[model samples]
Target chain A: MFSSMTISQLRTLLRAREVSAEEVVISVFDQIDKVEGDIEAYVTLCRSEALVQAKRADALLKEGNAPDLCGIPIAIKDNISTAGLKTTCASRILDDYVPPFDATVVTKLKEAGVVIVGKTNLDEFALGSSTENSQFHVTRNPWDRSRVPGGSSGGSAAAVAAGEAIAALGSDTGGSIRQPAAFCGIVGLKPTYGLVSRYGLIPAAPSLDHVGPLTRDVRDAALVLQAIAGWDGKDPTSVQKELPNYEAVLSEDITGLVVGLPKELLDNELDPEAKEAIFGVANVLESLGARVEAISLPHAEYAMASFYLIASAEISSSLACFDGVRLGKRYGEAKDTTSMFMKTRGQLGIEAKRRILVGTAILQEDNYTTYFVKAQKVRTKIREDFQQAFGRCDVILSPTTPTPAFTLGHKLDRPVIMYKSDVYTSLANLAGIPALSVPCGYTEGGLPLGMQIMGKPFDEATVLKVGHLYEQQTASERRLPQKEVKANG
Target chain B: MELSLKEMEELALIARLYLTEEEKKILPQQISSILDMVHSLETVDTEDVEPTIYPITGSGVLREDEILPSLAVKDALANGPDIVDGYFRVPRIIEEEYES
Candidate 1:
């Protein structure tokens, strides 16, 4: 039960001395022992290290006046570096590569006194939509083991949903965080680009990458965001802006708030169940005194294509450092530098290689203007679309994903189908706005459906507030996937 | 646009990935389809629009010239596959020419 508690709930008990940090950690680890074999959410578990941190947190609690997250156990996606821990990014190339220093967010989390449980699995270099692309193993949907937990942050979302961790950090590049969080039936927030420092996140796409929180509820997301959202000199792209207190906005009313439902997103090939769930959210918002209206993002249809081109182009350049020279595993023997480069780079997984190859071709002089530059121009249009829509409404609402979690390996062979899963979610990344996925309802099959609330740049306060309001109204829909997991097992 | 096997091989070479025979057989079709998907970007009229390389609006940050303690050589070389004198060891870059 302690493992299943939210951060706010655990904080009360921890501050009151009713439950020690060590007890919470042990309970979480116990749950891990119960279902990790079937769920496969984590790539690495630091039980001894977590226990050590928990014991430290208990000591701090004895001193009184500790941080809100003090003693909370949280998971970090494998792509984010943790000092003295292996940060594999779920790729074999970096299996034994332990970081000598922590990522900027990891450093911030440590300062807040949260015990890091472990590194969760992800797609190789965070390249794919499903954890099946993970070099380690597939992370199954806790709601249905036969399905994926959505990725490349699948493990983080799954861990939080199944009570393996109270909350977790996941990086979003083209819905890596939101999609998985939606699939796993939890709240996931992708902060405005440059809001969180990306100094240590293994980059999938630098321009599009954002590090954010995936938690059991919207309040927990705000708490984690409070700890990690800031600028760092190490990350030049990080914006120097004063962050609003995200937790303060949670109780605010949405009486006159205008929520926009993009006509373009709804007109796409959406599942009937997902469409129904999206409309159901509109009704709920309207009942809360918020006005919902249909808005158009004319260039929205081109987001997916532009995102893939931009992301792949950036990924090709970003991953060039793994040439087996400075770090990471090098492949077979070679006589010369060219052959060595080729052999060492051959360690990339199929999807990674595919993206890199496509990226390479896109960046070629002949195709540069046709693909890469065109995608960037289209990206400008996408951002303009969001800007125009936001002028008419405070926030936009849409399905976090087109549908709930699909069966594993269903779209594995079809790259385009897998890419299509990100269509609705990637628009936020392309526009560099904040988007949060809160569980709105569930399908008849019992899988969760998520509705995304997107806000203007650096307006995370409004986004979190909207999500928190919806979450409070729909509290009954919040259920752990444990029973479903156990039944499937 | 469909790519030929030769084109796929060229891309693999540029990416520095060594594709196997089977990958060579399947990748061309896969890459071509992905290309076809992305080609939709061309349909949008972007004649005069400026490209967005970075999403944020501000100019790049420039720090003052200052000496800062950085990663230790031992720590930097800790994860290297092969190291010599605290430097990464790699295959020979310059090839030796021989008289025929």
Candidate 2:
């Protein structure tokens, strides 16, 4: 089906006029119609708007000057603003909040002539590792209906995997993008910090949050990244650096490339099957002419703890704007402003409330140095570890998650366990480096396993190149979850 | 490191969130466990290690000091739950006695 085709494949057909953009949109909507009820990946589907954009793309295609992403149906995580569309971060507070403007990435995608299929679900405020924290219904794994599509970008990952959308955008604060991508069996890239602008993203943790693409393959991710990565005047943190053509490096040779496997990251918590998959990927990389070596990131053990403190502290401050008077749902009746604030803010989901409370506590005068500043110092150590590791290798390789997608509700009540699932993925966010998760292999149970490739700051080309080469070598292992979906249906 | 219920309630108050009865009952333990997990940072030696607050290191970017078009009043107030005279309406901050 057209929905199952990659952007690279569709770009050729589209340019050749072999298929109309409307046909592609219709095909995607057909897939969505068939499986959306089962997968529950989308919070909102812009069927009519997507059709309208497809029509515009068809006109642009006829002129023979359309952009690469013309007519590609894509899903956007609901946390990223889309003008005039409800941009609920899966929180009841902002359930009716429609953004007045598009996020920088959204605007960039629109300018590229892509059709936005809809906004996908996410963890409330993008704070949780599982979409179960979402106030909305949980997004089921397309691979196994009984399993969770890893989150907070679970809906975006699941949609791309199920062919509901060709590709989607997800923001990674701490494994929000890569872990879900790993769980859903797709390519998810979190570009180096400052590589992508974050002007209109509802912040979960501003310093660590990164907007990136989740796609069917590495090439599509490169395409999307090429279109969106750059400095934006609106986002002060956006780096003023020249962006490399990400697609240009995908075919480059890795004959002398050095890949490091950090012993510290390969913890006892890693599933035996996942451990085997990591070794399997290392073997594939070595066979493809890349050198693999064991390396130590000594400070890696503290990344999770440091990340939580930093993330929660930032989330508390960022979400303070959602008072009852302005945007978002206003709840309860009160005679005083304090009561008004309490009533409205109290509606936050359990995970969000927990973070806010923890964040507030961490930033308090007595606890600031103990928790917040200390985490920041450890964050420096973690970044220094990556710098040291990169001195000996081109990229770091590890399992994206301890295991593959777990059964739904398995870790919902256990927030700490759910947080632990991000151990392999959160370090990249903390270090502000580029990380990519590509499907490595499958578990005996048919769940997808992911191999993570992390590179130095502003070195997305290297990361994408390594992931692409690995993907090319293991092309046989690439399979969609349609068979399981069909069985469930 | 375990927080008392009273302490948890105070933290919630500081955060401007009203906890439900269940949250009041469970949050102290939940927050305390999370705190314990993050307490691992205390073990790391950070002597003389400068804190890295923002990932990107540099001076902030600045734009020209020129007037630019911004959101219209209508658009700005469009999402407001309560609006009065093109302004956000909120509960009275000053009571009758204070106003006098």
Candidate 3:
């Protein structure tokens, strides 16, 4: 039912009585039922609860109580705490854990009348590049079931692409949302850090973590972001600022907008298909009258190393609170407390434990001065690099991921190789800039590739404007994931 | 740059996860390789640079202090791993040995 409509289109349909909210929610359920068995996209789907909300939305809209997201259905990445809903970060530790209260973003979305249909699967503790790291089972890509939907936000991307939901909320620690969006051929945005609140979001690397949106189109992404953006006192990182009308920016022309591309960032180690997709988008922009130039952000070369050290260190500390004594899984009915500690965490996936250990090592006093402190300086340099590059251009363009969706087990044996999968997207997180991933084309193997549009700090409007404009120019539009999931009803 | 067996075991204790000797053996190598990869920051110079421990940008976020009622006890305990007599309960702290 939503295979062809954007969020705005769905809102208009609800407003016009062309389709009741129940009908749309029911359609989403129908789609989920048809495809989830084959795709295994969800962790949990609240069919009865979702329908109840849908009926209420229909009633509320009928009574003129509709808000911005009235009747719109979305799936949330399970790591984000959703009150009364199971909010596992796809880790065995929190397999059955239910959050006590809604995260700030969830509260806002509910206030806006957005109905959550389900919680989707993800990499354990939001750690991996592919959904296969999930403790439960892998979420297959909608484009090719044999391949993975790039992850930690893979299931959120899958749910949106498979049409299980209209759009989804995803947390990007190090490119989780953007990589998955690129793999699924959907549009994903990693907003400037602090643009969205993190209170109630279970921390992975809290400082690096950002809540963002994944949608089938750019305008829908913008609509979703508008509702979720803004400061919340509940989130320590939330910023206070006036909210902008995101929808108003879709028509802002990008003609003559200086778009810079530093070849130093590209032209090396990227897959040919990925290169073609990026350059193709540049050609489109050039024809659209945007002046595209190449410049160098010299400090950019050292970013991947800096990103890993910082992210891993924080992951180690933030996850320390998950001892079985407080919440989540506790293992070893052993003779002592030390044993209990070992038993519980040993059950954690190798990847999760691996990061925790590495993070702790980096945070050590002996190493902190050499590794942690130095990474911070490198991070400052990386931001400086972007600042210098942005001086000459309004936005920076690149491939979101260097390759299309890889085979599920492609890099499982080599984790470092896998971390590089986030290369193009992580730089923005370091710079605290807004960057978006939009479908540029498909690889010869049929996997979707994405092109990234990065904006100056706190300037998400420009990213959306360029993405929506590019979307409007293309005749080809998003197709629902090949599999169809229908409600059990 | 990876974790040693001792380090992995230490981390397991801190994280409250148990690991067998075999896992301890396997994890050290696995963790070390990745650590070496992320440790590329050793090449950087951060002297005199302020460390960035947080991502939020801009000025004072200090909020006015005010007393507020807390959530009901039941609500607070809603997600606890285990409970007894309306309170979160855990095994007696093993202070005899391996005390932090």
Candidate 4:
């Protein structure tokens, strides 16, 4: 029950002296110990340190000096650095590597007295849409063990869904967080690109990457976002723009709010069930005094193409640091300089290699003008498309992914199909806007379906507010995968 | 957009990755498929559009170049596969070239 409780609920319970932080943390770990074998949600559990931190949080709570996240147990994506902890990014290359410093988000979480339960699994360097690409074990969807929790934030999403962690932090680039949140029945937010600092987050694609929270509900997402959302001197791309108190905007009236449903994103290719769920969200918003209308983002169809080119290009440049000379595991005996670099770098997983090679090819002297530069121009067009769409509405709505959670290994063999999974969700990342995926409804088969709410750049407050309102108005839509489902699977 | 074996090998080298013969044989196809998917971008016309290199709108912050406390040598070398005298130890490439 403690594991199922939201951050807001847990905070009240902690304040009432009804539960100690240690109890909540123990409860979470117990749930993890019970379910992790089946879910494979975590890459490494920080059990000892978490308990130690929980005890300290209890003391702070008692002294009335606690922050909102005091005593809450949260899982971080493996890619985010945790001081002295193995932040492997779910890749074998960094299997034994530990950071000497915590990521900016981790430091903020520590300052807020949150106990970090563990680092959750991810696609190798967050490269894929499913956790199947991880070098470790694949993480199963909590709803059905046979299926995947959509990734590269799959492990973080699954952990929160299964009550393994109260909430988890996940980074999104091309739908990593939102798609997983949709598949797992939770709220996952991709804050505006510059809203959260990227100080120590392992780069998947620097320009597109965003750090956000996956929570049981919108309020918990807001709490976690508040703690970690701010500019830092360490990340130059981080914006100095003031962030509105997300919690304050959640309950604001939506009488005049305009919700745009992008017509292009709702192609007939979408699963009928997902389309119905998304439209159902619009109806709910309409009943709540919000105006909903169809809008167009014509360039939405080109989002995937541009995203792959741009993201891979950035990845190729960012990952050039891992030559095994300074860090990471070396693959073979080094006989010479070229051999040493080549052998060690070859330790990257197949997906990582695929992206790197494609990225390398795109940036090649003969191809740069045709591929890299062209994609950047299309990137500008995509951003402009969203900017124009925003002129007619407060936020845009669409299905987070084409469908609900797919069976694990379904799209692994076909790289293109796997990339298509993020089609509906990647547009926001390309446009550098804020987006949130909230549980809109469920399939008749009982799998979760997600509705994406996207807003203009640096407009996370609006996005969260809209998601929170829809969540509040459509409480019946929220359904958890039965515990017995996992037990039976 | 089709990458030949030679091109794949060249790319692996650029990426500083050594591939087995089997990887080299298969990589051309794998990389080609991904490139074909991304080729859709070439269809879009953006003759007048300026490329967006950085999504975040702001110039880099200027800071005084001041000395600061940094990672300890031991911690820096903690994960290095081979270390010698607090420095990462790699194969003697220069020596090997000279000998060859």
lDDT of all predictions: 0.92, 0.91, 0.83, 0.89
Tens digits of lDDT, candidate 1, A245-265:
889889999999999999988
Q: If you assessed candidate 3 against the hidden native complex, which CAPRI class would it receive?
A: medium
lDDT for position A194 in model 3? 84
Candidate 1 local Cα displacement, residue A81, angstroms = 0.8
Among these predictions, the greatest DockQ belongs to: 2
The parts of candidate 2 lying over 4 Å away from their true place are B98-100
Reference-based lDDT, residue A348, model 2: 91
Worst 10 residues of 3 chain B by lDDT: B51-60
Provide i-RMS per model in Å.
Answer: 1.2, 1.2, 2.2, 1.7
Error of 2 at A239 (Å): 0.4
lDDT of 3 by residue, A434-453 (tens): 99999988776667888899
What DockQ values do the models have? Answer: 0.76, 0.77, 0.52, 0.70
Q: A278 in model 3: Cα distance from truth in Å?
A: 1.2
lDDT of 4 by residue, B1-100 (tens): 7889987888888888877777777778877888888777877889889998877686366556889899888887888888999888888755434644
Candidate 4, A304-345: lDDT as tens digits: 888999999999988888888777888877678788788887
**Candidate 2, A1-489: lDDT as tens digits:** 898899999999999999999999999999898999889999999999999999999999999999879999999999999999999999999999998999999999999999999999999989887788889889999998888899999999999999899999999999999999999999999988888999999998999999999999999999999989998889988888878888998999899899999998787989999999999999999998999999999999999999999999999999999878889889999899999999999999888998999999999999999999999999999999988999999999999999888888898767788899999899999889999999999989889999899998998999999899888887876887665676336
Candidate 1 CAPRI classification by DockQ: medium
RMSD (Å) per prediction: 1.5, 1.2, 3.0, 1.8
